[model samples]
Target chain A: AQSVTQLDSQVPVFEEAPVELRCNYSSSVSVYLFWYVQYPNQGLQLLLKYLSGSTLVKGINGFEAEFNKSQTSFHLRKPSVHISDTAEYFCAVSPRAGAGTALIFGKGTTLSVSS
Target chain B: DTGVTQSPTHLIKTRGQQVTLRCSPISGHKSVSWYQQVLGQGPQFIFQYYEKEERGRGNFPDRFSARQFPNYSSELNVNALLLGDSALYLCASGPGNKDTEAFFGQGTRLTVV
Candidate 1:
């Protein structure tokens, strides 16, 4: 079984300032990591995913994440944030294979980017 | 192409009432999964269907059920709804059995009163 933990519940930043959302996971087997963004009253949209290869993954809206195997973490970062970036971000994980392997999500981090 | 689509953007039901939510997967996608998201929390898996068969089920009770049609559309039926059942029901679809990124619908907000 795999589980995800998002360290921060909320993060506040000024417009054009950088921000980071921390995420960690525990799994006995290989897993897939994903980041999703949810706007107010909207569904989750996949921001990015890390399957293999490059440890540094870039995503939409100028966001990026680095997968650190030694640290067992996948932290999302944005060089500069905008007010529109204010939303809820979630980190999710799923086992590599087998039956009933659904994505387990973290509690989520609320990003508040203000001007 | 249209993304995953769910019907009845909002619904209200009394306790013990039954409710059915619908979903239409993206074109060419064969997998559909259901999730329940209570306020201020991440979504919890409910069920997953592939090729018209049940592929997986989450920690939900038997009162929660779902099925996929030949066209890859799906329905989630919750029997004897309770106040705790009030949540946003999300539908996601992927192309295959592999862990590909899934597209989600806006979700149906079910309010059990």
Candidate 2:
């Protein structure tokens, strides 16, 4: 069994400010990591993923995340954010071996950016 | 290409009643997975079907069942609904390949009263 823990329930930032959302996971086997964004009343959209190589993965909208194997963490980072970036962010994990495996998601972090 | 599509964006059902939710995968996708997202929480995996076969299931009870058709479309059925079942039901599709990610639909919001 695998589980995801998102350390923050909400994050507030001013426009053009930096932000970081923390995520950690516990799985006995190898896994793939992902970050998704959800807007009000909408489904999730993929922001980025860490499948195999390159611990530092960059995503759309100038967002990036670093996969730390030792720390068992994948933290999303953005140097500057806009009001449009205000949305719910979810961290998810899937097993590497099963092509049909289901994704396990974190509780989600609400990112609120004010201008 | 059309992404995953779900039917009846919103539904309301009474206790002990049965409700079915439908999903159509992307043209080339062969796998469909179902999840339930409750308010203020993350999405929970319900079931996954690949190539018309059941591949995985989560911790949900047997009251929840699902199947995939030959065309890779799917239906999730819940029997004896409870208020706890009220949530957003999401359907996702993938190529059934180990190297790719799944695409999601807007989801069907089910309210059980």
Specify the highest-DockQ model's number.
Answer: 1
Q: In model 2, which runs have C-alpha deviations exceeding 4 angstroms?
A: B97-100
Per-model DockQ: 0.68, 0.66
Deviating ranges (above 4 Å) for candidate 1: none
Model 2 score (lDDT): 0.93
Q: For each candidate, what is the lDDT? A: 0.93, 0.93
Score chain A of each prediction against the true chain A by TM-score and list the results: 0.97, 0.98
- The stretch of ten residues in a row with the least summed lDDT in candidate 2 chain B is B94-103
Model 1 has fnat of: 0.61
lDDT of 1 by residue, A1-115 (tens): 6789999999999999999999999999988899999999999999999999999999999999999999899999999999999999999998777864487899899999988
Query: How much does candidate 1 score in TM-score?
Result: 0.98
